[model samples]
Target: MERKTNLIIAFLLLICFGLPRNLGAQKEDSIFYKSYTTTNMEPWKKTMEKMAEELEPGNYKQLFEVTLAWYGYIGYCLGNDKEREARQYLKSGWQFLEQLEEMPEAGAAPHALKSGFYGFEMALARYKAVIFGPKSLSALKEAAAIDSSNVHYLVEKGNQMYYTPSVFGGDKETALRHYEKAVKTMEAGGKYQQKHWFYLNTLVTLGHTFEAAGYLKQAREVYHKIQNLEPDFKWFNEEVWPDFVKKYGYE
Candidate 1:
């Protein structure tokens, strides 16, 4: 009778603490995303590797998601002067991505990640730009064709257009259009879904474009929207928003 009473108390405690059945899995995903959004690349990379290890070999959905996170983390590293570490991530990333490609359900997801990886590789060695650049472009095109409505693929295409040199056909206007399309698609998925890392990234990138173009009003609005979605987002709450207000004045 005492053992039964104790078991009941323990179950009540779990419920009272709000520990949902999937709390462990949710915690892992949340930590990795937080690391990414805060620009903590090294920790994000490590978290992603840890996640990859936790997932079973045949679990393609988790594999695809973790691999995508790892790809983004590597790109962040490459851009932030962490080339030595990024190189190691890139090598491991490629191996994981290659495995992801074999999953029939992965569709164009693997291609999109591969395109980003190639672009980063080109950034590291300009001499290889001639080879890797076109490959990246071609891979993105294939990914888009296969999954035209995919927000992730659209965001990547937007990134490529935004960053490519104007002489080489970069078009900010076109990039903005792709980004807007992605935003609309994500929005249609409902507000709750927008809190995901991918959706937040699309909105953040759009906000940056607005700020860079000197559209302060638009940028401010985007930042406010982000705050509404995630009030405690440290980077925005502590850094980007404060700096923007400092530069432009909070009217």
Candidate 2:
């Protein structure tokens, strides 16, 4: 009876002490997948904050995930009309990106993200465009040059072309080509072995590009491909597709 009682005490102590370490491990390793699978950024905000808190100060992998999460969080805030909150995330995201400067392969993503943030700032204030627009383009160019095959870099480049004015050398057809290259990069490299938000978002962007350029049939076909790829994506199924069909007169 005494032996049984001691074993029970030991087991309880292990549970008390071991769980935190286990949970920390999960937070560290699983954050990428967790962030990827969760489309809604509100809840992911808390999850990412917790993940960041659990990260060791100089762990580049965790830092990269946290930075990426901040990017998404900032976008979410901006989309929800929470500009103040978005600015806060943007500040942190910049700091995190700065921390990654030593590793160019990893730093390329941060540069790409910074480029997007600069674009966002320009959108918020027209005066910023004169200062930030060139900076945004430069950053993305650097990112792409650093890693020509990176899908993220290609996607950002495509985005820059898509949004720039025609007088500034923006061409929708060129943007479509960049996006296609990004998709091809992923496919050729098997980068989508795991469910990746970037890969999925790239596909969505392709569909949007088609729609924006008045390629109704191409856009509809892309949407069908998206449905086949991710039948469980609720927003795509219930909202984006339905609304897109109506807006584009796809019937």
Candidate 3:
């Protein structure tokens, strides 16, 4: 009887303590995705603060995931022209990346993140492009060379290809190919879970790329797919869909 009671206590203790380490990552991912879809940064800010307080030393994987979240959040701020807020986050965000770089487990993802950070810096000060532009491209290339199939690297490379001016070697066709390949890789790996923020983001980018390249039919299809997958995707349903409809008359 005593052995059975002790076993029950141990099982309950395991559930209380051990499970959170695994669940913590999922929880953060959920918060990040929700914030992204809803275009609300408040929850994201709270999660960042909480993670910063709770993260233990040498927990490289959690550090990496949190850093990626910071990268996304900083990008969101920059996209909205909140330069000051972006800069503030950039300060701590870079610290996190630097920590990842020093870890033995660090891989291509860190370089890819550096590429994104450089791009953000260039956006903040166009004059810095002369210095940061090549750095951004070089980091992305390094990341790709290290892990050619890395989804994050592929996405960043596609972004660069899509956004850079043609004079600087931007090719919409190349961008489309990269984005398509990234999406295919994710789908093939069964990584396109409905709650996966990055997968959804890649889809949205692909749709925008299609629209930019005048593939209105494909763009509409992609948007429709997103609608079916997540009808409450705030930015897509509220803003992207309306503008797309106004411009092209959705089928």
Best of the candidates, TM-score: 3
lDDT of 2 at 109: 68
lDDT of 1 by residue, 12-81 (tens): 9988775852575566567766775675655666677778778876888778767877777776777678
**CA lDDT, every prediction?**
0.78, 0.75, 0.88
Error of 3 at 71 (Å): 0.7
User: How much does candidate 1 score in TM-score?
Assistant: 0.82
For candidate 3, report its TM-score. Answer: 0.95
Please give the distance, in angstroms, between residue 23's alpha carbon in candidate 3 and its true position after superposition: 1.6
Q: lDDT (0-100) at residue 248 of candidate 2?
A: 66
The global Cα lDDT (0 to 1) of model 2 is 0.75
Please list all clashing residue pairs in model 2, or write none if there are none: none
RMSD of model 3, in Å? 1.4
lDDT of 3 by residue, 1-251 (tens): 99999999999999999898878777888888898888888999889878887888999977887798788888889889899999998889889989998899977889989999998898899999999999999999889888977887888999999999999899988999889998989888754466888899899999999999999999999999999988899988888899999999968
Cα lDDT for residue 192, candidate 1: 18
Reference-based lDDT, residue 175, model 2 = 88
Model 3: clashing residue pairs? none
